[model samples]
Target: MEDPKRLEEGLGHENKDRNEQFSEKDDKTKGGDGINHEKEETNTVVVVEQKGDHKQLQQQPLVKQKTKRVATLDAFRGLTVALMILVDNAGEAYPRIDHSPWNGCTLADFVMPFFLFIVGVAIALAFKRIPKKRDAVKKIIIRTLKLLFWGILLQGGYSHAPGDLSYGVNMKFIRWCGILQRIALVYMFVALIETLIIKQRQSVVEPNHFTVFTAYQWQWIGGFVAFLIYMITTYALYVPDWSFDVYSHHKLERYMVKCGMRGHLGPACNAVGYVDREVWGINHLYQSPVWSRLKACTLSSPGSGPLREDAPSWCRAPFEPEGLLSTISAILSGTIGVHYGHVLIHFKDHSERLKQWVSMGFGLLIIAIILHFTDAIPINKQLYSFSYVCFTAGAAGIVFSGFYLLIDVWGLRTPFLFLEWIGMNAMLVYVMAAQGIFEGFINGWYYKSPDNTLVYWIQEHVFIKVWHSERLGTLLYVIFAQITFWAVVAGILHRLGIYWKL
Candidate 1:
């Protein structure tokens, strides 16, 4: 049998030789492992084989370097980010493009989780390059802190407006947690376990003696344990202080109602607040008075209610998707992503098997069925319910696999370049959007002409007048607006080569 190491070394040498030839001449080469060159000096072409020990070549840095990023994965990530921006900025004109209120899924619901899954995939690729366990843990912690800080900043930090600090907290007041913050926390914990625990165990277990069940078996068990703990901690077991008193015959609902007179009714109803405050306490929920005061200053306005309302009714509360408990499930979703990344790495070129796709398809089917039938695990973003996590994960897996197949396997590329460009600079675009750089200009249209705001003009003229279909027209309008914004962003980033990294 031919040695795999020797073959890899020989391939690297051939690549190096080709590069050397190309540098020597001002021309380019084409084709596979063998090099065919055409010289600009003469219209002649030449083929050459440089003989050397492929084993020695294998030890070179080029041969031993990690795999190049698969473009399909980046494209998939870009598509996910684009969807996030569109859904986030749908401007109330297109309800269907928005996420489901509670206990349901929508096209918009899949975006954030897909980004999280991609984060897991990126983490898997990253850890391979950082060999030291302690060093990896330190790096993960630093990254997590940075993400948490940024999440808080985006949540409110640096003031909702410039030169405004009269609010309770510096800008981090509404510093409850967020999408990137959740991702950071999950990545930190997962990296710690994978490095300190899983890798250590694997090292002790000899490769030849290992079965899949024995070697990588801990991760599945760990996932289930985490899920079980989260469910029990969040739902099945409740703190006595927050529960109805059987002896006193006072229902919890009645208690909340009695307390409603203290400005606790309607939007101020503290049923959800009581649970988050009394049950989980401030540690997990992190609801400081300063944060509440900051929220009152920054988010108490008319149009911001829907987006800023954290604690609704108790029934609706846990389903907030971004709530404290739901984050546990989201962390588990990240674990699921990590496991999928492992499969991608270990299987590599063999991922095209019929069984693999079939298994993934079945996983998605099961999630869909559960999402349709089960009411206990609501598909609410606030609660981040187990069902919601499963549903989003399944959808994300399907999308990732599809992208991998199309871009990596089939070598197809096309109109997605704009998306790819923005994706490479996603954080920058998000921050820029948040800072009102584009919103300022977009909203400026409304200032000039009362009916000329982009959304208003589209609703009145494009949807109502030009097109008959309100929903479809409005949806298209949103897409057009998003694409226009993306084009501007892409042009700027392309010009400066300014890709933001965290």
Candidate 2:
């Protein structure tokens, strides 16, 4: 018998306990044979042996079991996490690698949604084959709390610096919600959807496609429902008295106007900002938002105002991009990942799988285009607009399809093993990144003046001097060097089997 409590390394339906069934069968046999029942329950495995003249019974301790893992899924998750580390580190130097300052999507804009999408995929991979609904719910609640706990305490959130904290500690500027917190939330809610609302079917050799819809159909239904709810909440449920026109910025005033959300409607007055402000309190939100930084929208021109005295020169307003309301659409992005996971599981034909991937990607992409062109929904990452959901989810589907084609279907996994290493220990690296432990380690190797570290010297001599622009060269060096640095770190951890998951 295998131990029931086993460590899961990678994603899949939490390995079904092979020993549970064996134990149950042995118990029934023991009960019929009039063997002691209480003894069987504790660290005991029954064994019957036959000698030349007599038969004997023996018991042994339970052993461990191995569960199935998906390598491609690991690749997907690793690729996303690695990129997150890359862009986050580089964004400090290169503005281009960072999120789009405002409404439009940039390379960095795709990272978060893609990460969410992978989470969705992970949920399906982890629980699709699970039959115990109660168990699924339990796992969801527990992991949600763990992630949320760390998210609140990590960097870019609470003021944990030794200098900032003294006496009672200054808690006024602490952030209430963040990236990990949002991932936890989306995972919990979406897991509930798959576990409770959409009941899992029994294992099957061939899962029948939604008979009516040739495609998996769950993807379509989930996407449409998520978007419908998001659209209605964002547009129809508008707060009033706050107009759409460009206005002013105040440290206290997140939205453009001084009237506040007595009642406001429009892009600026979306529920995403309102809920975060009311629920988390303005002080707890990110002091400077990604969108407001480098771009200014004010009373006169679109983003055409001087840096408000209340705010920093880069950004004065405290608007949480990963707000409570935005989580609504983020779930949709994750739903796309869940759909892809199902496609991987149920479909065997590589060509058919490829076709489905293409179909799903294009379908969503076209819809997003229509929404953007019609002006019915703009692709605003700040708001997590319906168009943005569609666009990003579509992009995620397409990117995953590429991985499916090159890695899973083709089985060219050797090159992607680097990413797999990172993927396997995604949470560990994520926490380290959030804590800035990676930066501290990098600094520890230097023994020169504060500004004359190995990285700085390389940037100065090899990058900035060789390249034309100081900022551009520095940016390029960070982008390349940081990703390589993190990849090596992730690789080392993976080699040591140090995969940390909740």
Candidate 3:
């Protein structure tokens, strides 16, 4: 029998095992009257041999059993992680793919929601059969705590900038929220909701257009409730004028901005920033936001350059991208992911699952377009707007369904096998690659000057000189050097059965 304790990785954890009893009859004419039957749990194949033939049985070779898993899920996760590394490393040279300054969506914007959506899907698969609710909830809490701990240690101003050699962070100005922190919050709430409403998941399959919604109605209701909370608070909350201190040219400067608005969605007067400032403290928020690259804030519109001489007071105020009020809408993204995951679980046929996913995906996209075109709620990633949730979640559904069609149904997993390796060990890739830990370590060994390092040399000489274009060179280096390198690293780890789980 294969080892029951096999490792299956994702954004979080996903493990499944089933036990059943069965009997198999073999031919009784193999030079013996009786049969030597071997049976195991979970629909394993039975190998029959001669009852009194020890020498013949000893000559048999070992056979390995493969674990059942959704190959599309791992491939999708790997694609997302690979995108994260691309944007994080190459966004400086390529501004269009980077995060949008304020009001629109970009390639970088999809990474966060993709992660949250993956968490929701993973939760559906992970909690498919929870015999003990108490133990499951305990595990969820522990995983959430672990995510929060790593989020703070890695992203909470504890480490220096990628270029800076210094270490340590000021306790007063350490950020309290980040990418992993947001993921933790979304995971905890969504997992608890799914656990409480586990009874709603239908046991029998109903292959209808609306069966997915009907089966998990409570989850949609919870998602709607969260949406309403965010909408109401964003529209009704009164944002007072705020001020913050910034150190410019070795001098402490205080700047004030006038708000006194109810529903201002500007970079400075937004309710999301107001809530984060009030709850987490201005000093504890993200100091450098992508919004600083806005034309009104800096001379450069998309690329980050010097601040404009006539920049507004809010330009200097720190704003948390993963703020508190904005997280409500993010929950809706997770809820949509749970819906797609439910489709995977309830529908056995490939066509049926794709139909459900396509229907939901198009429905969300239409709603997103209506909202954005009508100016009701423009798709804004920084705020995690309602339309943003619908747009990103819808896109995720369509993409995942496509992956299923290609990798799972069509049986073409050869090209995407590299992505599967990264997906299986996504947590390790996140820490080592996306977080720049690996690059920082490599940068530690320099020849003469502090800037003379292997990574820098490759980017400057091998990539930059080959193309004679900074942007193109940086993009290619990220694709080949970082993304491809990590894929190989993850592949090796998967081969060795090494996974760093939260």
Clashing pairs in 3: none
Using lDDT as the measure, which candidate wins? 3
Q: TM per model?
A: 0.66, 0.74, 0.88
Rank list by TM-score? 3, 2, 1
lDDT against the true structure, each candidate: 0.50, 0.62, 0.79
Collision count of model 3: 0
**Where does candidate 2 have its weakest 10-residue lDDT segment?**
30-39
lDDT ranking, best first: 3, 2, 1
Cα deviation of 322, candidate 2, in Å: 0.6
Highest TM-score: give the candidate number: 3
Over 4 Å off in model 2, which ranges? 1-69, 159-169, 197-202, 205-226, 240-267, 293-315, 441-469
Q: Give me the overall lDDT of model 1.
A: 0.50
Candidate 3 yields a Cα-based lDDT of 0.79
